[model samples]
Target chain A: MKARVHVMLKTGVLDPQGEAVRHALGAMGFDKVEGVRQGKVIDLELAEGTTEAEVAEMCEKLLANTVIERYEIDLD
Target chain B: MKARVHVMLKTGVLDPQGEAVRHALGAMGFDKVEGVRQGKVIDLELAEGTTEAEVAEMCEKLLANTVIERYEIDLD
Candidate 1:
């Protein structure tokens, strides 16, 4: 089985990196780009039968900085 | 309109950050974790009617390091 976790900065938190990207885009003449929010994706190959519960635990414990980020999980 | 770009390392390339996260997960007792790959997500708020082609161009020109990364774009 596999699990994909998408971790993103929570709304209302400042994202300097994202701001930088937006600025870069504007400078490159991609002026139509209004905002950019950067995030991370963690792709995990799990042992058979590994549950979503355990993956969520991983997100909470290590994969995401829950104070400033929130995560979504997709299983396959 | 909005678009999401997912950028990932080419399979043959090395990913030290992914390796570091894998090590941390193992140390934290996620022994069932067989592999871990890390990537980035860029969420873009685009002007209405922004085409996928423009977003793809952005990926090639700025959003991703084309020599070492490949990107997938989703528009909505």
Candidate 2:
């Protein structure tokens, strides 16, 4: 089985790294870029029979900081 | 318009960060995790009508290191 997690900062939280990228894009002449948000994607190859619940548990336990970030898990 | 870019290390490239994550997961008791790969997802809010070609150019020039990473652009 395979699982993928997408971890992103909460809407109201400040993202300095994303801000920097937006600023840099503007400076580089990509003026049409209005906003940027950066996130992480983790792909995991799991033992067959690993359940979606287990993947979600992994995200909650280690992959995501639930206080400031939200994570979505996709299983395959 | 909106665009998303997923940047990942090439298959042959060594991903130390991913390896570290896998090790941590094992220590944390996720023994079923066989492999892990970490990547970045950048979401961009663009001016209406921003073309996919422009997004691809951005990925090539700034978002991804072409020598070691590959990027996929999705426009929405």
Candidate 3:
């Protein structure tokens, strides 16, 4: 089994990293660019039988900083 | 219209950021945690009529570094 979880900054959070990208893109003539938010992806090759709820809980508990970020998980 | 593109390193690529997260999670007492990869998300608020293919082109041309990262876009 494999799982990939993506964690990112929540709306209303200030993202300096994203801002820097936007600035660079704008300078490169990408006027269509708006905002950028950074995130993380975790890949887990798990032993069979791991539950999706358990993985979601991991996102809530340790993988994501809920104070400023939201997360989504893809399981296979 | 709005578009959100999520970009991250492709599989088999070296991800030091993800490695650092795994190590941190392990130190924090998570035995199940495995690999971690960092990525970015860009959010755009566009005046209607932006095509998905065009957005994907922007992703390839500016938002993502194809040498390492792959991207997915969401339209709304």
Candidate 4:
């Protein structure tokens, strides 16, 4: 099985890295850019029979900082 | 308009950060993990009427390093 996780900052949290990118884009004349939020995507190759709950546990324990970030999991 | 860019290291490239995560998961007893590849997801809020080609250009010019990385753009 393969699992993909998308980890993103909570809406209220400040993202300096994303801010930097937005600034850079503005400087480059991509003025249509109004906002930017950067996040992480982790693709995991797992042994057969791996469960979504197990993946969620991994996110809660290590993959995401639950306090300020949120994660979504997709299995394939 | 909104655009999402997924930037990932090309296949066969060394992903040390992903390797480290896999090792850590093993240490935490998530033995079913076979491999992990980490990447970036950048979400952009754009002005009205922004075209997909414009977003692709952004990826080519600034969002991704074409030498080692590839990017997929999704416009909404």
Candidate 5:
């Protein structure tokens, strides 16, 4: 089974990396680019019997920093 | 318009960060986790008239490294 997780910064959290990307785009002459928020995607290949709950636990325990980030998971 | 771009390392490319994460998961006892791949997602808020081609151009120009990375663009 495969699971895809998207982890993004929570609203109001400071994202220096995102800001750096925005600045880089600006320097590259992408002047119309208004805002840029960067996040992460993790693709996990798990054993067949692994449950969604276990995958969520993985996000809570290590994949995501809940204090500053939120994650969404999709299983296939 | 909102565009979501997912950038991932091409297969056969070495991903030190993903390996680090896999190791970390193993250390935390996620023994059933087989493989992990890490990627980036960029959320872009563009002017209403921005075209998908333009956004893809952004990825090719600066958002993703085409040599080792491939990006998928979704506009909404």
Candidate 6:
């Protein structure tokens, strides 16, 4: 089984890294861009039969800093 | 309009950061965890009426590095 997890800063957090990237893109000429935020994705090749709840539990227990981030999961 | 974009490394790419994260999680005692891959998410608050194609074009042109990653966009 395969699981795809996306982890990102919670809303209202300041993302300096994202801001830097935004500035970089502007310099690279993508000036239509007006906002930028950055987060993270985690791909897992799980043992067959891994349940969505198991993955969600993993996110809560280890994969995410819940104080600063939230996560979404996709199963494939 | 809003778009949720997920950007991630292509298969076969070596993601040192992800490897490090996996190791870190292991150290944190989540031993059922067997693998990890890290990517990024970019959220866009677009002006209403933004087409999917336009968002995809933005991704191809600026939001993702196609040589190293693939992206998925969701409109909401």
Candidate 3, B51: how far from true, in Å?
A: 2.0
Q: What would the per-residue lDDT of candidate 1 be over residues A5-66, giving only the tens digit for each residue?
A: 99999999999999999999999999899999999998898999999999999999999999
What stretches of model 3 exceed 4 Å from their correct place? B26-29, B33-35
What DockQ does each listed candidate score? 0.90, 0.89, 0.44, 0.91, 0.80, 0.51
Runs in model 5 lying further than 4 Å from the true structure = none
**Considering DockQ, where higher is better, how would the candidates rank from best to worst?**
4, 1, 2, 5, 6, 3
TM-score of chain B of 2: 0.96
Output the lDDT of residue A3, model 5.
92
- Model 5, A1-76: lDDT tens digits are 9999999999999888888888988898777778889999999988899888988999999999999999999999
Q: Which ten contiguous residues of candidate 2 chain A have the minimum total lDDT?
A: A1-10
Please list all clashing residue pairs in model 5, or write none if there are none: none
lDDT of 4 by residue, B26-58 (tens): 999999999999999999999999999999888
* Candidate 6 C-alpha lDDT tens digits along A1-76: 7888888888899989778867876797655556778887788877777789988988898788999999999999
Whole-model lDDT values for every prediction: 0.94, 0.93, 0.76, 0.96, 0.91, 0.81
Query: What value does the lDDT take at residue B75 in candidate 2?
Result: 94
TM-score (0 to 1) of chain B for each candidate: 0.96, 0.96, 0.91, 0.95, 0.95, 0.95
TM-score of chain A of 6: 0.94
Cα deviation of B53 in candidate 3 (Å)? 3.5
Interface RMSD of 4: 0.6
lDDT of candidate 2 over A14-60, digit per residue (tens): 99988999999999999999999999999999999999988988999
* DockQ, computed on Cα atoms, for candidate 1: 0.90
**In terms of lDDT, which candidate is stronger, 4 or 5?**
4
In angstroms, the error of model 6 at A38 is: 2.2
**Model 3 Cα lDDT, one tens digit per residue, B4-57:** 787878989988877877787678766665566666667766546878987887
Error of 1 at B43 (Å): 0.4
